[model samples]
Target chain A: MGQRLIARRQSLKYLGMLAGSVAGREFLAAWLPKSEKAEPIRPTESSYTPLFFEPEEFSAVEALTELIIPTDQSPGAKQAQVARYIDFLVSAASEYNPALQHEWTDGLQLLDRLSREKYQRSFHEISAREKQMLLEEMSLPEQDSGRTHPGYKFYRLLKEMTVEGFYTSQVGLIQVLEYKGLSALSEFPGCTHPEHQS
Target chain B: MGTHAAYDVIVVGSGAAGGIAAYVLTMKGLKVLCLEAGRMLDPSRDFFTHKFPYEWPYRGEGKPGQYGKLPQGMEWKIKEWTDHLYTIPAEDPYALAPGSKFTWTRLRAVGGRTNLWGRGCDRFGPLDFKPKSLQDGWGEDWPISYEDVEPYYDRVEQLIGVSGSSEEVYNTPSGKHLLPAFNPRCGEVLIRKGAVKLGIKVTPKPLAVLSRIYDNRPPCHYCGACNWGCDVGARYSSLDVLVPKLSRQKNFELRTNAPVHTILMDRSTGKARGVTYIDTRNGLEYEAYGKAVVLAASLVESIRILMNSRDREYPSGLANSSGTMGHYLMEHVAFNSIEGFFPQLAGRPTSNDDGPGESCLYIPRYNYGEKDRKYLRGWRFDFYTGCGMGPGPGARFPGFGSAYKKKIKELYPAAVQMGGYGEGLPFYWNYVEIDPGGLRDRFEIPQVRFHTTSEYDHAFAIRDEMYGQMEEILKASGAEIFPYEKESPYPLGSVTHEAGGCRMGNDSRTSVLDEWNRCHDVKNVLVVDAGCFVSHPEKQITHTIMALAYRASHHLAEEFRRGDV
Candidate 1:
């Protein structure tokens, strides 16, 4: 993945020179799973009723969201109640955009079919390792140019919602991200660092 | 009070120009009736200022299943906030020609676009009025000069309270009564290295935000919600600054939802007698008489009114004998931006970078005096930093997981996007007219067919050249420029700094209005809005719009007092 990223950056002429010189270039870093906030996420329970999804589909969706942005030190999407939020959103918006309901139903149903074909079990019924592997398999075609894979497309859509739901929630924004905005500051302390100036 | 009241002057559209015109005219002891098509906006009630994304019902993307263009970006693909600020497209429809690329966003509030404006207060210099004359002479020049509107500029800055530093620049002149300027941020300070290397100045932007106390209005607390409407009345919105003062004046009266249909003309006198307007709430049309009529109904709307006001006396629309109405349409070329982040600021503790809710740095038009040029007119640079706005920078990053989340946290505060904007040369074919066969809105006013004949091949060439210079500025500052697919200016009419539908010039044969914004064909009619702008300088033009309207209103007042009409 790291080599592919470097090759892709180098392929673009404008990025060719920077790839060799800058050690701070993100592609040079290790592709290992080691990350900050590596502790397990204690996801808060939400008694949210699924609006669009059936009980089985909702459980599978909840699992997928957690896998995409799992809790480490802070709470994850499960704690943010993102799947329920998405289900409610799709159901409410069905009147205006009927295609959305079809997209979600079909996407989740495809996830079930793919899991059953691969492992002879539903997505939620699969092992934790099997779930991650299946998701990564869906994610692989995302980097490929021009080929719009439906499984990869669904993964991208799911990831977008998970990221949006997590980052916008109080658990994601204040608890984890430590956002410091919308405050009345008497004075804005701008660029006092000596190294940053010259 | 009677529904029909006789007025000394009738003003249309209460945004930047109409706001100033109402204040000036009413204060001049004239009974001014300001007609705003939009309903009143309550800042405290309507404004979604300082609101968290999670606080709203659907987390600021509006109600579930509502599909609209995400005001910014592709993903998270809905209104994250300030969606209610704009006029609904279905409610206010306009036509776009077959291949025309124009995205018109209108603010439905009383103050119009100023409620959510960036609050840039850049004053036009002496050379700006003669945009074409000073250069190789390709376009038209303003009927009025910077000298003719200098005192009005001084008056506007005094009333509005712009905070900026004197860089001693030529194009962006310093206002006489400016409040103290804000200190440059880490991103702004870092980018100056590239600007200095390129022999250009990056000065603190002249903004209408009050830095210190002025006119009993409190100074800006730097909450960074200017685009979402300022709730504290710190920034200069027409609702905050102009309407409050206008409310006190006994001669002033604001009639909301009264959209002006046409300028009612008396065939005998050969002058604008009054205007017929529809009261939106009642579905009834009424006539309001005035000694003089001020058409400050924005650039497109004011021109639409004149074009719709056809009669036996003046068939080619009122005051349009030259057939030059709706010609010479102009919009400032903007939206080509480079998303970048300072690698140095990565992994740093997050601090609030929303300094008064707008970019403080400005690379004013330096190529105005230069001999060589990339395109027709020069482009200026300004940056907007959206620090601590949640995972937006991470969208560009490949892959997702705990590592992705960690990377987003590290880079969230380091994000900054700088854009280049330039002067748009007036094209005669690029104009807005009453839609030949378009739907009328609820108010029964005919929709406008917005048209722009710009291929943007020249615009792309300008941006491509600008990218090289802007890239150098970013690269020198150790900022990683994010590669974006958007390589040209935003579709024309997207940048709300849209001006010029009825051009003002010395000759009535080629222009619509005279130097004082009064129509040459009809003496009593005046266009005090940006509709009268002959050409735009290489900067954000709302400040110049306010100054021109103030000067024009004063001229109208003088003319009215002298019984010139």
Candidate 2:
């Protein structure tokens, strides 16, 4: 699986440079190291245990995060272990920022309450289609006022945290986004594109 | 009381001004004793610039309650990664008026703010010295001219290894830079192209970072973490560049962690005897004597020392004869930034774009020579590429998952931002005074109370003009402007370019220091810091501070030769 991923990344880099995209060339320069390939370690769904959430709560958070950034052509939030990262963040927040800890607890409780009211079951047990419909309804603000639904505000927070957790993770940044920086370069490569010139 | 041996000169604060003063004075064969309030920091162990976020406990974003614990005025100074470089406000506190909001961003370390300064080493033009002459009713003109300080400016630039091409911009005077200029990235090129259409000249910014190996210091490795503290001696910090050189000289002696309480004065001759300071480690008071004293202890701190020094002859303060010890506190007021995405550079492959944080292009003050605006002085603009490292602002990117990831890559390289820094007129109302009701620090020394106010009409007018020009350039480049509300000018000291409080002029009643930066009342005492600045120009002040220190120290050496000091 690791070899296949590396091969795919190399091909994508080649195709990007051939098409004259600076982003693709940057990926090649940053990722194509001369040393042995060091594959990033990611926690499997089975191996991970929740520190902040209960088993049921963890299941709901995992389901919600995965749905928010579901696996398509590339690895998604589940592979990046965004739920576990969020659990770790919330667990640590209990000390300095108790308000942040309270926000997470209340937000999770709101999700549970909404899921039980609509489907008579927990959020993880709800059907994917039903989950999507419920999320769409939660996303919109009230008709009379500009304020959004409490559940929708929770969704926005969760989504923002999930995006941050995923993009910063090795799997997301290297494999998905292909970020290439923090290396010592002899010189910087300025813009070479003629189209960008006036 | 004087247990220590007498030295030729005693320099306070070992930052930019003090560093230059010590070097110049000692090199002239005068015995100098330098006292610093902060401990020395070893960059190799202290700097966390290259550390990855994952390696840190909270991913380099402070711990949950960490920010809440920071004191009100100090929260902006301490970033999660750079917290070690700043002083904890709870431990070292200052007072402010009830409704006033002033951000006194300070570092109590040996190198001071220079260790983590934005290395924008710009030279002040001829108009900066004579602001009253430029337009009436601004402020008093500087006693010295650009011609008087030009030679010292060139000497300091070469010693510090400034990198830039010479663009003959009138306000940003040219210098004999030591290194080649950095080439502009795609985003900067676009900015230049758009600015040309508006008849604005954008040239390479003169920075204090070395482009090539010079004077045994290595060139910048393009780490892009200049503010985090450079581990290698590539960037110019007094600790790295000046202190080590001064340490080699036999006449120079540096004492760290010795916070000066007051300047000891001789009552009979009215000359500065030396200084009495507390040992920060053991809390024991010690006095050091010298023939002459140079106050290079930053702007506010120097004024604090002077104000605290009260004798039978001068009850108010040591230099209160002019009554201008702590007045005319000025800071550069920065306006909101104009940021946008250049569509043409979208989806371009990324490379190691990590260079110094200094902008590749600098738009000098063009409002001068053609004064049609309501405001008196003008502003300058700086252009740079990249939205910075790490995960992008997820809140801006709507939606989640794979599609959002695609958008992040597309928008990453296209990021371009331009920030405006305008000149703030020095007002007498904005000043720092020792609290009359006895508010003192841990050392029992009285704390300073700041009362600062800006010219609202002039500030707002400059902001509107700058924002309008920025929008025109962004629109001309065919870039999508970010959705941001226009903001009011930042509060005083927000830019960390604080000046004045002890200004220089010909008149003794109006100014504290003379043209050569010597205190008017005391012949042997001199202030060679931002406090000597007559008018606060839009340009950065570190280069000028160092240049003035060298010029004043040279003058002091001449006086010593003639036995006038």
Candidate 3:
């Protein structure tokens, strides 16, 4: 029965290959549409016109993103091209709910203003220590300060987006975590494996 | 229209539920009509070959600020571009009281939501079929037991070719599966190790996607094109397998783009005579006759269809004489869970080789058995190690130059992640009611008023516990935990495993459908979907929904032979 099944599968494969051969490249193209390709959101140039934010706002946004997902041994937020993705996402973000846009814009402006008051410097220019302190302070409850920081809302969006984008990325998912998908020779490493027990 | 095409069975909606129903009933030599609302998709052309979000006009992400096609907003958008066409818009006046948000995401296309589902298939154990007995005064027990539904589940596992291990089956029931089950990648192995150290039962998640060559379908290719649609036909979507076979049967006639208006019931006996539908193309109205009618148009749409068939017997609507047509709605309460970064698995190159099922691992419900909890029922966690590269949000990262690409390449496969996918128990107060005077959907019918779980504390508390448990497991796994900032909860109907509008029970007065999934007031009409679930299981909702469809279709076919209807 196994032999018969194998023979049947071989025949099916032969038939499939023959059909493919008969239906050449042009046939395949007409028959099957092409996949949509992922394009780089940022321009190739180092200094390009800011689409979503002014230079000042962009600098503050950069600092805020870094705080949410800091760089470690393997490049973190600064290296991921996430800022470009955000720029593209925001510039093209005319169709979103009003609450989301308001939250994001308000949050960024608030964070930058607070940074200027505390450090007498732009948010991006603040020391990493100062940045961390500011983040921690903003994360605190409003009852303690009697004023809720605008940067807190920006932090929320940055944190959520960072996790979502980072985890879904090819780099973050594969190189970092080692997720191996469908393997033809995939073996079931039973939880009871003595190695696992150890 | 012509001879009033007769059939032994008529299964509507060519989804996980309707497809299985057609395959089972037709294999028994019963003539079946499987009607779907969307176009028949050609897998080679329509599926994974080119399904990047970037491929669509919106790139799978809709316009910057536009409310998506369903009008519920873009955050809750279903995968397909056509999903925009099939789903009901939010502005259609689907009534919900203030602060009571309902996220009704239904796919009316050929394969339904199974095409873009999470591929997590689990058995709803005996505890789920009878939740009322376990807790009290919340919902009804299923007419069928876990034992009664056990054989059907086994048959389904065999037919769909599931990849799972029976040993991992704890409170989440298991069946005779195709293979032992695929294992977690190295990162998942570590997370599982940590979770187990915390006394959490982390096991291999059972997925509907093929691990090995089962039946005729190919094994998963590990392309991770599952959220869009798998063109290779490895995933468990009805279009890939069941509906295609059913279409080959001479008696089956599937009509796509046929938006069903109402189930035309006889005035004298309240029997389902036929269905009146409008062809979405020309806006022409046509009726198809069947000895029996099955409403498999999903939970939300099915409720809408029944509510539209207004008659004297069912003054509220057909099969709704009991005033329970659209009530006790339940949705799996979900959120983007606690995440953490671990440096242990860094430096590995990207491995985008696995399909949807291959990404990670599953931690079974460890809170079961003699455990005192803040909530009655329990929830499970899905763990996956992140690999591969994609752009991050600007708010989260920096750099627009080649430096960014170089960095992304370096960090592609080094992130380990886990999420808690919990089930919400049915609360009678959390239900769907129809607004007769509300503005209609695209179908021009009064929209369903959803008053389901919004302020339910038990469900919320259960979610909080899930967050705590997830953090414990991550800490055990030796990772720096990134805790959930807040309970960023999504609205009901967002999880897409939306169930429990027309719950099945022995009590005819309270429930719309009986144990066999037959409508109590209208014997000839069978309602099968997530809506028929007595209680939402700890696992995902597709397998149970498919199994219930089969059971109901089989019973309906048997009744047709017996001339019972």
Evaluate residue A73 in candidate 3 and report its C-alpha lDDT on the 0 to 100 scale.
Answer: 43
- Candidate 3 C-alpha lDDT tens digits along B41-80: 7666655434433344444445554544342222433333
Docking class for model 1 is acceptable
The candidates' DockQ values read: 0.30, 0.19, 0.09
Instruction: Encode model 1's per-residue lDDT on A1-198: one tens digit a residue.
Output: 001001111122222122222331343232223433323323324466677788778877887888777877667778788887788777877767777688788899888888999999988688776877777778654333333455876786687777777777888878777777777887776678788778
Residue B75 in model 1: lDDT: 17
True contacts kept of 1: 0.42
Which structure among the candidates has the greatest DockQ? Answer: 1
- DockQ of candidate 3, scored on C-alphas against the true complex (2 decimals): 0.09
Ranking by lDDT: 2, 1, 3
Backbone clashes under 3 angstroms, per model: 1, 8, 44
lDDT of 2 by residue, B1-565 (tens): 7544489999998888998898899999999999999899898888887775556666565675665555332443466667877766556777878766576777878888888888888899988888888655567889998999999999898778899888788767979655898766777788888888889888888889888899999988777777678888789999999888988988999999998989888877888989999898988888999989999999899999988997777677788788888888888867546555677766777544456556667788887654567776888887656534544322244344445555666666666666778888787788898887678977787888888765468888878888887788788766766545577777787777889989998899999998888888887889999999888888988999999999999999988888887
RMSD of each: 5.1, 7.9, 12.4
